[model samples]
Target: MDADFLLIRKMKQGEDKAFDLFVHKYYKEILTYCNYHCPNKEYAEDLTQETFVRFFAKLSDFHYRGKTKNYLYTISGNLCRDFYKKVKEIPVEAMELTEKTEPMEHQMTDVVNKLTLEWALKQLPDEFHEVLILYYFQELKLKEIADALKISLPLVKYRLKQARKQLERLLGEEEIYESGSKTCEL
Candidate 1:
C-alpha cells in the first residue's frame, strides 16, 4: 500500500501527528510543483495552501485511483486555473523571470548558461515543462513522472521526446538527445 494510503487512514482517524507528518513530507515538493507551474511566489504559496486545504477536506473521500503525487498536482492545476480566473492577469513570462543568486563563479559563462536554461524551461508549455522538470530537475524516474503527471508511461515518453526536440530547436542545437545538465547557450 502507498504511504498516502497510510496517511489517509491516519487523517480519517483524526490523527493530528500524522497530518503534520504528511504536510512536512510533501509541503516543499508541492510548493516546488506550484512554483514551477505558477512562477509567482505569493500566488504559488497560496495555491499550495489551497491545495492542502482541499486535500484535507477531501481526505476521507480520497480514492487510490491515481498516484498521490498526481492527485496533488491535479489539485494544484485546478488552483492555477482558479487563480487565473480570479486575478485575470497576464501570465508570467520567461524573459521577465529573475534568477535566484548563486555563488559567483570565476567565469560568467556558466551563469549565463544556467539563466538561459531556466528561461528556456519557463518558456516551455506547462505539460512539457512539468514532465521535463520532474524527470530531470526533480530526478524522478519515468514511471514516477507518469505517476506525478497522471499520464500514461507512453505519453510521458512521447512528451519527453517532444520536449527535448523543442528545447533543442529553441536552443538552436543540432544534437537533440542530450541530458538536462548540458548547457544551452540560448
Candidate 2:
C-alpha cells in the first residue's frame, strides 16, 4: 500500500505522529492552492488550516479509495469557493522575481506578461479559472484535476480548451501566443 494509505490507517487508529506526518507532507501544497484562490495571505493560511481541520473531522468516514492529496485539494477548493461568495473580490497577487542572468529588459517584460495573464485569468469565470489553476499552476494531470474536482475527464478537457480560448481572446492572440506557440507549457 502507499504511504498515504498507511498514514490514514494510523490516523484512524489515533496515532498523532501519523497525523503530523500527513499534515507535513501536504501543508505546503494545500497552502499554495489556497493562496491562488484567496487574495489575502492571512486568509489563505486560515483556509489552508481549515481544510486540514475539516479533513481530520471526516477522517473516520473517509475511505482510502482516492489519493489523500486530491481529497485535500477538493476540500480546499470548496473552502475557496465559499470564501469568494462572502467577499466577492478577486485581486491580483504581486509577482516575485528570482535572480536570473537574463537582461533587465527581458525580466521586466516577463513580469508584465505574467501580471497581464493573472489579470486576464481573474476575469474568467470561476469554473474556467479553477481548471486552469489546477492544470497549470498546481501542475495536476488532467485525470487528477478531474478527480479532485469530482468531474469527468472529458469535462475537464472541455473546460481547459475553452479556458485557453477565452484567455487568448482576453490577452489578444498575438500577445499570449508567440508565433502560434504557447507562452507556458501546455
Quote each prediction's TM-score. Answer: 0.71, 0.81
Model 2, span 104-130: residue lDDT tens: 999888767756776888899888999
Give the Å shift of residue 87 in candidate 2. 1.0
* Backbone clashes in model 2, listed as residue pairs: none
TM-score winner: 2
Question: Listing every candidate in turn, what is its Cα RMSD in Å to the true structure after a full C-alpha superposition?
Answer: 4.7, 4.2
lDDT of each: 0.73, 0.83
lDDT of 1 at 40: 67
lDDT of 1: 0.73
Looking at candidate 2, the ten consecutive residues that score lowest on lDDT are: 177-186
Question: How does residue 44 of candidate 2 score in lDDT?
Answer: 86
Overlapping backbone residue pairs in candidate 2 total 0
lDDT digits (tens) for residues 1-186 of candidate 1: 778788878888999998898888888878987765564677788899899999999987887664777687778877876775787554535323445475456235554665566577767887888778677655578888887666899999998888887887777755333345643222
